[model samples]
Target chain A: MTSFVGPELTNPRAERVKAVRALSGRSMRQRTGRYLVEGPQAVREVVRFASVHELYVTAAAADRYSDVISDAHERGLPVHLASDEVVAAMSPDAQGLVAVANVSSATLDDVLASRPTLVAILASVRDPGNAGAVIRAADAAGADAVVLTLESVDVHNPKTIRATAGSLFHLPVVTGIALDTVTDALRAAGLAVLAADGSGAHDLDDLLDVAGPAGAGDRSAAPDLAAPTAWVFGNEAWGLPAHELELADAVVRVPIRGQAESLNLATAAAVCLYASARAQR
Target chain B: MTSFVGPELTNPRAERVKAVRALSGRSMRQRTGRYLVEGPQAVREVVRFASVHELYVTAAAADRYSDVISDAHERGLPVHLASDEVVAAMSPDAQGLVAVANVSSATLDDVLASRPTLVAILASVRDPGNAGAVIRAADAAGADAVVLTLESVDVHNPKTIRATAGSLFHLPVVTGIALDTVTDALRAAGLAVLAADGSGAHDLDDLLDVAGPAGAGDRSAAPDLAAPTAWVFGNEAWGLPAHELELADAVVRVPIRGQAESLNLATAAAVCLYASARAQR
Candidate 1:
């Protein structure tokens, strides 16, 4: 954490303000190796768990979320109390609280070393909101880690961070790996690789029926939930291509009892993750 | 469906185009009793299922989505081919296809008459995307219908319609009803009203363990899945208040094995609905 604590920043057009605001763009974020964490909830999480370069808060926001500022101070992080206009200028949607965090430190190797029982893998998921929702759902399902394929949306996107509801800081999120590499690594790590797709032989309900000890009643060839598993979710629009779908040991579809062409990516991911969580229990 | 077919609309500022664009706002929709449906997927579904007032498209779009146009023509709906500028002026997100449809014909009483085995109730949900996602998830789970309390986001919001991914046309959506009335009506219809809250007394997994005939283990007082049930989800930010929580017969919580505070409204709704769908199977 930077120790550049200073008096109240009253100038909205200050170079520091412009620098922080620039992080909202992809090129600026890459050049500075920093990303914007907006609003009180996300800013709080970053302050507590990530390497926050600086924290900007308005006096009103400072009073409202005192714990966040206090925690940041306790962690030896710079907490800048900026004017309302100055804070808003940095990021309009930040609610007067913003944090500049370094790029992620999480890697697939580190996550694999922990021997995760359940994992969520997003392959080419383009929607930031969808990706964030899946991460939050994965965390709720007690997943050990989440991996985003190379073609997926950037995990550091501000929209994705907001969508995670602070769960972004709760678990390891490995990004920028190829889909095939992710499937191979998770499988090699002794976890079954299951891809969530509309075209699949296994019905999720049937898998639930024979999962765990008491229900391991018969099907010898069925993918068993007794072992650790990783689920790969495809893009929000096109879904998994044949090659990507072929990477997993099995492709499973969440059954649609009604006439919906398909459930949106996030909801489908939630159902699949929760099912796996229940089965592995 | 109206038969107001005429020459291709060439002017972007035409009164017809202005009127179609105006339907995107709430007041215009209320005054005209019509809402805008954008994109080919939604336009197709509205044409097939709802009372579509008119259809607008560009020549290239009509060629790309010929089936949509053919179906609308067969249904005797007015099909207006507009220039690219005119179509874009009608609704930028429409991607060259747009439709104006009457407000929902779905009513709670009509839904009740069908003896719905499963239903989802949204209370004071402000986010249009969350409302639509819940509706879509409920439809995918085979829920008979969806109901939104009077305080919830308008289901006709273009964002909400798009979030539904066309599921809005697949099932009945009852809106503008109070939460208490919705609960009471569903309960009287022989369905157990369960409120999804983080402070619930019953764990969803524990309930699932004893659900269905095969696993009807012990737990006599636990809510059973053998009978019809209705789930009520609270707002996205502030969950159910004490008074609202008191309206349900029981409260059930989705187990959070990880550190997430709570699941997002839509994802949480999906988990609960799918669990019910699985158990009721």
Candidate 2:
């Protein structure tokens, strides 16, 4: 690995620093075809999974995370040593490490081309934090991909990326597609699209019952969770509208055993995704 | 009902306003023995389940949420009209409604005295948001109570209260108890304490399989979720210590089917609580 012995970039208003700071905004990210990944966990994942256009690290952070710097340089990616002020200027939440990476141009068609067995479709999910948490849950559930419809929060939002906790780099996440398009594509792929909502006719427990136990023999008698499936989560406040629910094969509700009116989007997504993961595994 | 034609308080520095604002801080909350509940949902819940010391609403809010005002008056609670500035000073997220309510003095002994069938114990959870989400999940799962160790986040933190999404009033949440005391008391009460951690001897799926379906006959043949049980969730970042995990009867792991390193504390708690809910119901 080539040693990155370059002088540390201390000027916060440097031309390169301004460009990196601009990546924090949506229009700039879209225009430049790049996004910022902050913190070591996110930076590490981005470097490993996506093409890192450039890596920035404070001198102290560089020493603390030499492996990351070496790995980036070994990948033929430039590693810049930035001062603490420069790092802070890019993103306050960045723990002395940040990276500018090219945003993936993967489309829904590209993701579906792999015939994903399990997918998460977010329809009109507005909160960046919730969207990212759902993506993390989907990644933990081993879902093949995550689809954010046109109205969903931007996947490149910094808060969303932070909430993903590095899972954003672990799986394919397609964004900006229409909800109808996603449902049709997943259905055509032979995956059952289940809408998660409180007013659903079916209970999650009943669905799991029909799916049988994980790794059980005579699985053919069960609902076949091993079969391709997609879970469509709705907006946080209003949840899935009637038309949206109608698009799915069935609407499933996580049974509220207590007085809680409903689960939040991310928690609901976690329970639903984990249920599918348990059944499929 | 008595008519509330009281003069509207417009000053942000009003004594009542300062008192409500002081509830936002922990020391003030402890000194005054009261806390602030913001938003219509939280304020409504406080009026219904807890004793409201005072209810403050802006003119527009009073018009929008006349039901809440009427309910508070019906409950013999004082209702005061405040300027938007005063309400904003108390809490920017109050949505024109805020309430000062006496803090619940419920103890671990009081909670266990009811012979809780299912409970959630939080050990050293630091994040207010995570703590609130766990409480919400526990409420959704029909947990009888929630226990937070001394090391855990303050249950009355405004952010934590908001995170609970009004579920904070749905159940009894006992805080500031020692972890050892909680586990010991739970065990003495004949409740099996299950520590939820990534590293565990038993898989959640296997445990669920043993629990069988909800409302199934011959629950004695399987692990009966209807039986008294307590699930202990750890901190957000480092999770439970080895000593803490060993205190429980068994350590259970939520199987990670995907490439994700692990689930967030709140999501994991949701899955664990729901599993118990499904088996119990």
Candidate 3:
């Protein structure tokens, strides 16, 4: 075991911690192409994803998570011992583990070139949790890609990343692509573009019924699950902006017969994405 | 305009603001049988629901909402001017209007005596938003009542109330009941108890299908719509406790073919509730 570091120590043995703290902001995250992970859960996920550029553990936590630390260390990942003060300063809810990893930063061209079948486009989603959940849902639905408009919350935001439950590391999520480009590219790919609208013309169940089973044996009867399709989700407050809705091949609403005015943005996105998955099944 | 003159304002005219601020907590809310409404939107909702005990608005907000305030006042409700300081102290996000309204508490007797067809039982749900959304969904699905387990978050929590989008005022939401009493009473009422589990033996869709349509012309094929049925949603953190699961007549799960472990609690509840509504429809 490494010699016990004094708990009160506050020397900068690693410059990466500072770099990571700076990445907390949107500008810094964009510039550095790095994102921060906080607490034991996120740290464990980062280790599983094995994309850790730098890892910081409090001396006490290091003792507790020696296995995780050693695994990352074996991969030549930089490991630093942070004083409790440092950890507290770095994480609002520090459960004694933190890590920073470079984001995948996949491009739209890369996603389109793959001839993706299932995809989700988020236009101006504001909540970090919703943004993260959409990406996570997109990943779960086996979407070939997730595209984000410029106005959407940064996927790398700590809250957003946490909400993804580490699926963000696995999913091919791309941001800053204009809605027009996405719509045209989807059209070019022969994929139907469906937007989730609060006041949509058709019921979501109807769309799913038409799409057929995601993994149905009867190819002719199925809506062709392998055929490229993009499910678009909008912001929680105002929903999909009208201009973006114009690009949709079909507008669908999740039939909410309930008194709840709206579902949480993330929940709505999940329902839509899952509907697509169920339909294509 | 009536002048405020409560403990909140040094000036006698600010008493109205003091009364509104006093309703922030449960004890005070119960004492006065009143609760505080925050934001212009919530005030509008309060007015629409016809439960506004008193209305308080800042000068600027009153100017913008003169029609709304005047209408409520013409209905013989008191409209008072709250200084900016009063509204700020009353509601952090006052958004220019606040209202003090009678607490619309629903009791078990109130729920059962109504002869509800569909009821949702919330078992220890801790998140305000989740609880509020569930209640709102219950309202949307036309559920007769929402029963909360003893440990569940307060339905009247501002965040939960706000999440309901004013459905709290409209919906018959009951809390502070023992699990056994509520479950047994529901059973006695001839309501089949269906609990939502993340990995239940039955899929939600399948359960809905098996239940058949409510009130179909063929009496043998479909259950009567007026027959009582209760759907149970568990806590957000740990989900339905094992013992609670055993109490349920049947367990149902929303199938997830994706990588996500589970849907958010509110989303899961909404889906299940909506599925039941759809089956009945």
- After superposition, which runs of candidate 3 have C-alpha atoms over 4 Å from their true positions? A1-17, A63-67, A70-74, A113-115, A140-142, A208-228, B1-16, B208-229
Model 1 C-alpha lDDT per residue in residues A1-281, reported as the tens digit of each score = 22236789999999989999999888998798999999998988888877888889888888888889888889888788789999999999989899989886599899989999999999999999999999999999999999999888888888999999888899999988888888888888988888889898999889888787664434446777666889989999999999998898888999998878899999999999999999888
Top candidate on TM-score is: 1
Global lDDT for candidate 1?
Answer: 0.89
Error of 3 at B213 (Å): 6.2
Candidate 3 lDDT score at position B119: 91
Cα lDDT tens digits for candidate 2, B1-281: 33554888889987878878889999999998899999999998888878778888998998888888989988988888888999998998999999999998578888888889899999999999999999999999899999999998888999999999888988999988999899999989988788999898778888787674463445334344555779999989999999999888878888887778889989999999998887777
- Tens digit of per-residue lDDT, candidate 3, span A1-281: 44332344365444644666777788987787777888876687678764677777887898888887877766777677778877767776667778888877789889888987788899888888778867776776567788888887888888887877777766678888788888898878878787888788777655544554453444334333334579888887788778889998767787766455666666666667666665555
In candidate 1, what are the lDDT values of residues B1-281, reduced to their tens digit?
22337888899998988999999999999999999999988998888878898899898988898888888889878798889999899999989999999996588899999999999999999999999999999989999999999998989999999999888989999999999999999999989889999999999999888787654433348888656899999999999999999999889999999989999999999999999988898
Query: Candidate 2: what lDDT?
Result: 0.87
User: What are the C-alpha RMSDs, in order, of all predicted structures?
Assistant: 2.6, 3.4, 4.7
Structural similarity to truth (TM-score) of each candidate: 0.96, 0.94, 0.86
Candidate 3 lDDT over B116-176, as tens digits, reads 7789999988888788877877776678789888998876668887888777766677888
TM-score of chain B of each: 0.96, 0.93, 0.85
TM-score of chain A of 3: 0.85
